[model samples]
Target: MATFFGEVLSVFSRAVEDDEEELEESEEDEDILRELEEKRQVRVHWGPALELIPNTDHRLHCPHLLLTVGHNASRFVSVFFLSRGDWDAVGHVSLWNERTLQSEGSACVLYRHRDSHMLMCQVDCFVAEDQLFQWTEQVLSSLEPSQVTVLSDCPAAEYQSAQPLGTAPRLRSIHTSACSEPTCCPPVELPNLVSGLPAAVMSFCQLQNISAVVYQCYSDVRSADSTAMDTFRPAVEQLAHSLNLDLCPDQDVLRKVISQAAVQSNLYI
Candidate 1:
């Protein structure tokens, strides 16, 4: 009698599982597919200078900070901090070309701007080999809500290769010709390129009339979440809060990433 009852219970469970699977197949929602398509982020290419002008609707919000990812051989990437109400350039930060960074072995550039309510803004950067990946999250987390747009991947092959527009200090980098190995150029040895960085950066803040702070966060984690990365979060969050911006992330998703990283590290070690 006991065996017979157990057999009957197993049969009922199997039947219920099959019915639920069928129900799931039959009730699949089309709206979810539509939302997925609607929520996709579009990539915008800035031909020369990195353009960060936002969509018209976004202008109604606060000021937006625009970022341009400099290519390995691209010239100074232009950054515009635009005022939402008037669409005027409140300030800007110009970045050195990639070749220059490789030779200098760091991310250093000159920044200058005007003075206004937007002065003393905060900027935190995650320098990576490729900017397109996780770019949306980088911009969102680093900038004010609805106040960050990016212009990346310009076509120009080399920075300063083309006669640049003005007396803007030209950025240079080491390059390898097809037939030759890597060649290093004599450093341009500009003042700021040497020791004037803090002053130069501060000049931009002063011109914009706002106090500013810039954070350089290392790209040590490949995934969104890692226990090791958690240490960096507080500082990243603090930087955003200083700029009066909120930081967001899916904690559950991040935790999974961290767990995976731990497992992978254990396996390798």
Candidate 2:
């Protein structure tokens, strides 16, 4: 009985989305978009917390937040504005490059944006390594939506390698490489590379200016004997698994993420 209704609703939802897409692409709607990418929250950071810019809309409705998935893709990144407890099927955007996240690590950041009428939240994470990425795919697929939202993979220039936290020391890890560009530099230390989950999230939030965030980290502490790094695929997957097993909080877990975000805001940087 429940399954029957669920299936029916899903079919209807798909039809509506198809209609909306058509309408948006219609000649009349194209003119509307040219006027103002108004509801478009893609590039705009909700705030320092969720990387969402402050509200630019003037609608009076419900309180909700947006989730932006980051990836290597080049097209407009998919962004979703969701209400609290919106575990229903989500969306994914096109990913231009999948190989990017397979190498380094990225921390997820949550942000809170306020306006005269409403408050919103936004979430960010790497596509390849984060468990939420899987959850999103599954949920969106279940909804029978036309496509999933995927953010562009963070390019090499923007990529930051997260190192093993507890196992190795930070200072000793960074070293200079010779015979290169004039700038000639050593490995840059990434705050996201730290071992402690709290520290990583804190660093990510601080870096992105997203006031609130929920992130759990897994660092690869390389061994001194061999000096070669392990493949990032398995390392990142293992860490993501560990984070899910530990019940790490995310925007999906509002009470906890909100509480933690508050604490992070109050922390004495």
What TM-score would you give candidate 2 relative to the actual structure? Answer: 0.20
Return the TM-score for each candidate structure: 0.23, 0.20
- The CA lDDT of each predicted structure is 0.30, 0.28
* Best candidate (score: lDDT): 1
What is the lDDT, from 0 to 100, of the residue 50 in candidate 2? 29
lDDT tens digits by residue: candidate 2, 35-119: 5443221222122222212233332232222222222111011111223232322122222123333311122333222331222
Clashing residue pairs in all predictions, respectively, total 13, 34
- Candidate 2 residue 269 Cα shift, in angstroms, is 48
CA displacement after TM-score superposition, residue 236 of candidate 2 (Å): 20
Model 1 TM: 0.23
lDDT of 1 at 264: 63
Query: Which regions of candidate 1 are displaced past 4 Å?
Result: 1-211, 216-228, 232-249, 259-269
Candidate with the greatest TM-score versus the true structure? 1
